[model samples]
Target: MTLWLSSGLIFTFAAIALILYKWWDMQCIGVTPVRTLVFIAILFTSGLDVGLIMFPLTEFGGYGNVSDNPEYGFANPLAIEFGFWAFLIWGFYFLTCFYFAIIEPRVQFFEIPVVKFINNVVIIGTCAFTAYLLLANLPWYLPELSSDDGVVPAFYAIVFLSIALAVYSSSKIKYVRILSVGSSLLFIALIVGMWFRAFVLGQGSPADFFGTASMLGEYFGNLNKF
Candidate 1:
């Protein structure tokens, strides 16, 4: 698994390097050209999901226990968490966007009927899986709303409503842009709110916050190990 992951990382970087070398000054215009901020907002929202927001707290303990999980010993738990969520993982998205924006029009490989059908099927499957993840994790986050078996109608209703809203929003590009930018702003606000709560309202000092954040430097310092 590690070898496979290493190879993927190497390939992603190589592809990114080649793309940059070939089109250093080229602008990527999408089907509908939007401002730089909207483009970034779309990418930011599309590249992440609720799982990322909820994953670290659950995995941090395992990552920190290097004695049991020696594979994670190369870096601190914070570093491991950051490495999982950021850095080279995002390169895959970059490559996909680049391909669709720059290469797909020329090749038209995805325009084939079978390929388009398969692509849409994969997209629908992905969305279903994402919704399932939310449904499965909701009980843990909101135990009060869950039954004894960790399943409840309320959870199902919430997930159904979420999917319904997402489908409705996706019917138009303007709705997608609005939701993407709004969600990005909301995520930023969430981060700031948490930081303020932790350092300002809570007992933790500003220096403590910085000290905790600085632990992420281990990931950068030991990038090759990751």
Candidate 2:
């Protein structure tokens, strides 16, 4: 698995470099070309998932336990978390976006009935898995909404409602644009609110914020090790 991961990382980086060299001046006109801001909003919202919200809270302690997970010893837990979510990992998205935008138009592999069916199946399966993850984690995050045996009916209802809303939003391109932009704005507001509550309203100090921010430097310093 490590060898495969390493190969993929190398290939992604090489491909990114090749794309930059060859198509640096070329415009990536997709099948449906929207404005740059809309394109960015779409990618930003699509790139995020339940894992981005839940992973750090669950895995921070595990990453910090370098005695058992010596592979993480090269950097701090915060660095490890950031590395997992950012940097080279984004290259995979870049390659996928580039392929769909540039190469797929020419090859039309996904236009085939079998390939389209398989792609839709994979996408739906991924959405279901994401919902399952949310349901599984909700019991721990909101125990009041769950019973001792397992997830409660309310939790299931919430998940179903969420899936329904997502499907409805995806029914039209205009809905998708509105949702993507709205969600992006809401996320920004959420971050600002949290920061205000923490530093301005709460007892958090600049030193505390800076000290935590400094931990991310370890990731940059040990990029090769990662």
Candidate 3:
């Protein structure tokens, strides 16, 4: 994982510097899915302090058990893990977003919400909370936060959405059915497509996950050697 864990980080850190340079000169920026994905990917790579309460239990159950350097005597191995997971992964991205929010022109993404009852309030709230786990993981030095706080809410959102889906499927209400069924099918299609491409086509293992760097690095490795 040298190319992935070490070299890739160096590449992204340089890329972030390039983006910051471009942002400085361009004065106008376009938001794209790729950019956002890259940005979030960086945060997930670098930051971790905010993730103290984001999981049900320890993120790395046994990865951090062995000491990296016993002679040096580091305090917590998990904080070191967070250094990779949350800080390196998403920290710069969050700061960049903050910089954009303050410096750039913005669009209003809001509409009238007079009829809150008519919307996916529970779904939206739960999803937002899930994302907040990443943000909270940003601080990286938070004293002590319960991982259950984020996990429980995320579980609630899943349960609520599941129930809503169950009801929708059973009733098959005209409008709801269109969206629910279509989205469900679309989601399944995407999952199947990616799964086939990743594991079957690429012959990747559990480690062969996430980022263009990983995909590109594994091109020859994932092939039929035998």
Candidate 4:
């Protein structure tokens, strides 16, 4: 797992470098500042998520784990790993897409880049895998995504497929587009709420609100609620 996770982060780091290089090259050619920023936003937000702040607090402050139980003495090394990689993945995504466009000039990304064949497979696979997990992990697969209710591999599979769907679906369906936009707004609200709760209402950190979301532990559908 460590190797897998580290390798992915390394790949993203390399891609980010390549992407920035491409951006600089584009600027030399004639891309406008506004266009560059727009591309930057798309790339930056690609890996953004609800846990951006929460997980760090949880892992570093020692609030995470299946039992909220840190290893008692040692800090979680993996938490740092996750934190570092989280920063890279979004840029990594943007970099790859931009790089692909510069080189291929016409091909869509896939494997997560929106290449047509890859897109078809990902959406279908998402629905199928989700159905299978909800079925196999019956009774308790929803709580912590790392639940004991279903096939363990299913949990891993969904982690990524869900991400792929979120990225790919916006271009494919009106409903999904609305949903993606709505969720993006919701996420922004949630982040702002985090600060509000922390400063105004004195609700610990915004991550404290995540505990209230435990009710959705059993919800296995769309993430509009989160």
Top of the candidates by TM-score = 1
Model 4: how far residue 148 lies from native, Å: 14
- For residues 40-127, what per-residue lDDT tens digits would candidate 3 score against the true structure? 4433422232353345134444434556444212324344444434434473664556455544435322233644443468656755
User: Which lDDT tens digits does candidate 4 get at residues 184-218?
Assistant: 67768988976787768884754655654543332
User: What TM-score quantifies how close candidate 1 is to the native fold?
Assistant: 0.87
The clash count for each model shown is 0, 0, 23, 7
What is the lDDT, from 0 to 100, of the residue 24 in candidate 2?
Answer: 85
Q: What is the C-alpha lDDT of each candidate?
A: 0.85, 0.85, 0.47, 0.51
| TM-score: the better of candidates 2 and 4 | 2
> Model 4, poorest ten-residue lDDT window?
217-226
User: lDDT ranking from best to worst?
Assistant: 1, 2, 4, 3
Superposed model 3: Cα runs more than 4 Å off? 25-52, 60-75, 91-158, 161-226
Model 1 regions more than 4 Å off: 1-4, 65-74, 220-226
Q: List the residue pairs that clash in candidate 1.
A: none
Candidate 4, lDDT over the whole model? 0.51
Reference-based TM-score, model 4: 0.44
lDDT value for model 3? 0.47
Identify the superior model by TM-score, candidate 1 or candidate 3: 1
Global CA lDDT computed for model 2: 0.85
Report the error of model 4 at residue 225, Å: 33
lDDT of 2 by residue, 106-181 (tens): 9999999999999999998988888898888888788777898878899999899988999999898888899889
Candidate 1: how large is its RMSD? 2.4
